[model samples]
Target: MTAEATTRAAELKQAQAALQQGRFAEGLAMARALVQDDPGDGEALYLAAVAARYLKDYEAAEDWLSKLHRAMPEYGRAWQEAGHLALARGREAEALAAFVRATRFNPALEASWREQARLLAAAGRAAEAAMARRQQERLARLPRELVAVTNHLAEGRLLRAEEICRHYLRTHPRKDANHIEGMRLLAKVGIEFGVLEEAEFLLESAVAFAPDDVQLRLDYIDALRRRQNFAKAHEEAEKLYARDPASPVFRSRLAIESMAVGDYERGLELFDAVLQQHPRDPANLTSKGHALKTTGAREAAIAAYRAAIAAKPDHGDAWYALANLKTYRFGEDELAAMKEQAARPDLSFMDRVHIAFALGKAHEDREEYAASFAAYDEGNALKRAQTRYSADAMSAELARQKAVCTRDLFEARAGSGHDAPDPIFILGLPRAGSTLLEQILASHSQIDGTLELPDILALAHRLRGRRVGENRYPDVLRELTADQLAKFGRDFIENTRIHRAGAPFFIDKMPNNFRHIGLIHLILPNAKIIDARRDPMDCCFSGFKQLFAEGQEFTYGLREMGRYYADYVALMDHWDEVLPGKVLRVRHEDVLDDLEGQTRRMLDHVGLPFEEACLDFHRTSRAVRTASSEQVRQPLNRKGQGAWKPFEPWLGELKEALGDLAPREI
Candidate 1:
């Protein structure tokens, strides 16, 4: 740590100690100083808030908590402290609501659960009180370290959560009961940290160790699905569904996993069954709309989305799903409903975010540019606050790849990997038309279109040796033996086979794989890699407007997204220089201008004979799982072209970040 940071850490420790010892004045002074130095420090703000609450300075406590909550919206302790402050002023209803929010954010908060149970019982809500007490008992049964880990995870401190979880597991390895929960918690951290392979292995082992544990099995299924083992995930889901076909949770899991494995009919049927059980269930209705939307059931998808909105007007996901359809136009009632949801103080964070982005699209469709940008910015700001993305760190990481994956490294490792010629990698920035290319290529008889396969990303993560000082990923590529590299390549092929059928070659359209192109070449030298490029303005702005399911944190801000694009371009240029004739750069606009020519070129690059079906890509029926799924299903058009023009005045940050790479008009 820096000298200043070390001193600040010491001060924080002293303040915390004082607070624990009932020295509220001293602790408050120290915390206030720290907050003055760094107003965004959540811990400092939390300490200040707590001290103020203890001192009965309710107004000051509220101010500190407002700052803390804004800086760390999902921090359960902050909300717990808020609840305590409300109770100090005899606001039982407010305290109850705060405690409820606290538990929602972090179920490990036993105090929140206890308070909720007490408040609910006082309110004569017997069932809610019982539920809250049950939750409190559940937390009491678990290890304290797991509770801390869960709180850390809830507040987005993923690295700290992993460290505590690992230490706890190592200290109590043979305690099967504790071990299983620890492993599950570690797996959750792994998932949040994008270490999918570790997460899958951990969850799978936990499941094997406790097959009767329903939660473990559910977590295992989630990890498997994230790792793109759709069939295996579906198998696990099927087991759960068989165990209890009437369970809404199992039924929903089966429905979603069925969609993953390309059984859209079955997924829709299961969704219908769930709806039958609870017809006004907003989440299920929204999920059904998603399954319908992805499978090209346009009218059905629209109806499902509207039904969800009708059932629960504040359910923002259903509203966002309609907006995500890209071609769906919002009616006045729908627009007003979304605006109402967005304005609701009680709306959940994600629901508010979903409503904001949905409103952004709604206004954009109506050509209300300023309102559109404002809503989009609001949603992006919320997501940005929740994430811990660093553009500088990303730049440094990309630089390491360019530095370590040199021509000499390739020359020395020549012929050192498995000779896999059956894989085609479509990689680049997310909104850069990779889905379109995959659709066109998968249209060929020999090529299979798959979900954004996670195998390559998992390999890259494995290459990142440990979590110490600096990451040793592309650099570690130099230390890996030929056998190890070959095995990695072989394992990737075998693991990903579940996503493919009889096709000789399949596309792994994981856009972030662009960051690990060198790793790809080192492991599978003969695999075809396509660099899918798009117009910077359209790509960056589209990414900015998007609320990704997860990851791609850079897209939550215009400047960061633009900077990432520039870094990506520079890294790809390095790859071209070092690995000449190895990557084929395909521009989205060029493809639009000459579809048949580009199609033939891509086929030729993969050594496939040109087929008419490649040109008739939009006609090919397949389940696309990306945001651009709907767009790629229709015939070619410039629907996305110049989309940023309407918001050009508000895009100075993006233009400045893009530097000379941005369009002259921008």
Candidate 2:
């Protein structure tokens, strides 16, 4: 070989060795030098891109891969490298397209097909996933035992997979390739089946056996997070971050875990650190903005949100954050931008809801009732679509659990004689005008407006022990004695007292408070319970469109949403039956139809005088976090009452489930 060729070969070998040893910067320098000498070499360019990706230099990786693709369009390795680069940068569509190209170029690439299937499944394109699965099936045949065990696991015949894995472990007695694969299969089955305990144990064992495996550590973190072992998850995340401090993915994971455990300060710091390295990361920017908003840095939060939008024009969460920030830091110029973004048809369903909801509030603030109602209608429609697809038996079960939580809660309060401070609660399905009711009540001078405090739900979750399923409530309640219940109630009051700010009364307007009405009645027998009832179709459909953090699976499926809504009504009816004269049902339509009459009745029910301010609730200066923020800023209108009309033609499936769009009670 010539001297130049020999030197290039030597440098390429050294680069590969450097990369293997995690000396990414050193490897990248050498790889680029080798690539410059051998521009036609696909392997060199691929290695350069891999090094760039490892260094988290997404732009460099993209540039390198783009040139490689241009130079050798049919090169399977270039396509595969591009796919990896795309996935690393969170470009799923680009990744899938590249993977498709790779498979086309080299049909014999078994690993490429496997990765293609995994990516498609992750993206929720089940048909595409099935196609990739077929490719894997056609490429190679597995041993009968492996195939049989995999099939059994897929079918949730876990005992068989366990037996096979155990036998394999016993016979192998070492981490052979087959044994490792079996363990991996075991972990996969556990995760897919939601077998938390088994998944946790298997992941722990896997991590122990392969401590250096990043993927294994990630899997273990996922299992622990699912189990709500936040402390352990945070520790694992910290350890992972220490291994790769510059990895935005690991940093984000740590931030998320910290936020989950109410460590908002630490979460914000971590998020800020992530943004420092990746200033254009829209997700990190949005998260940081949200953390700021929650931590009371309202103006700074708005600025961060704007920065996020500037970086990623289509970042919906940034739009939502800006809209929320405008609540206390109102701006007329920003309103137009908020409205425009909220109405963008190209936005995703959840983004559309957020934008619409924000725009609605902004329009309402300007007293543009027609525009506000239109925004609300669009937002509500998105929520309905979500409920149609996601809600199921799980919602019913959750609602039941919530009701039991309420019962035990109230039973504890029964002996106090005095209702807990801020006894008035507004509860119903979210987007059902609970916020509007709170705004109206807050205008009463007697009531303070506290945006949804999750104190009650948090308290209930804390009281729960090692039990699952529907029947766990009664047994759980039996464990809370009167004294303990009073202490719990007192604790709830103390936590929320900050929001009350010395007001004689405050509206704890958590829409999900419907789940805790039983507790509300028992704790404060005299506490007014306003059940904000909207048209079932409108409410359920609106819920479907919303992307809530919890208790919203029913919103994803029409049948599930319908049944869940029915159960919610049934349980509320039961509360009314057992408690008698406690709940005052306030129809959204009725509130719209006769604002004065409804306002008077609402005030009277809560033992307040009929003040003119109650009639002018739209002018109240309180910050609302609910989707109704916009609508409540305007005078009452019927535009939202029959909102299901435009989408009425497409809601046949839902109509069949709930038997019409008209308001109904079980």
Query: What's the TM-score of each model vs. the native?
Result: 0.88, 0.52
Candidate 2: tens digits of C-alpha lDDT, residues 115-177: 889888987888988888887875466444555566556434576876776676677755464
lDDT against the true structure, each candidate = 0.90, 0.69
- Candidate 1 TM-score to native: 0.88
Candidate 2 lowest-lDDT run of ten: 465-474
What is the C-alpha RMSD, rounded to one decimal, of candidate 1?
A: 3.6
Q: Residue 296, candidate 2: how far off, in angstroms?
A: 13
Q: Per-residue alpha-carbon lDDT of model 1 for 1-666, expressed as tens digits?
A: 899999999999999999999999999999999999999998899999999989989999999988887666667888999999999999999999999989888878999999999999999999999999998998999888998998888877788998999999898965557888899999999888767777888888888888999999999998887777788999999999999999999999999999988888899999999998999999999999999888888899899989998998988898889889888899898888787776654466788899999999999999999999999999999999778799999999999998999999999999988998989999999999999999999999999998898888877776675453446787898899999989998998988887887899999999999999888898899999999999999999999999998889999999999999999999999999999999999999999999999999999999999999988888999888788988888999998999999999999999999998998862
Q: Candidate 1: misplaced stretches above 4 Å?
A: 1-73, 77-98, 115-130, 466-470
Clashing pairs in 1: none
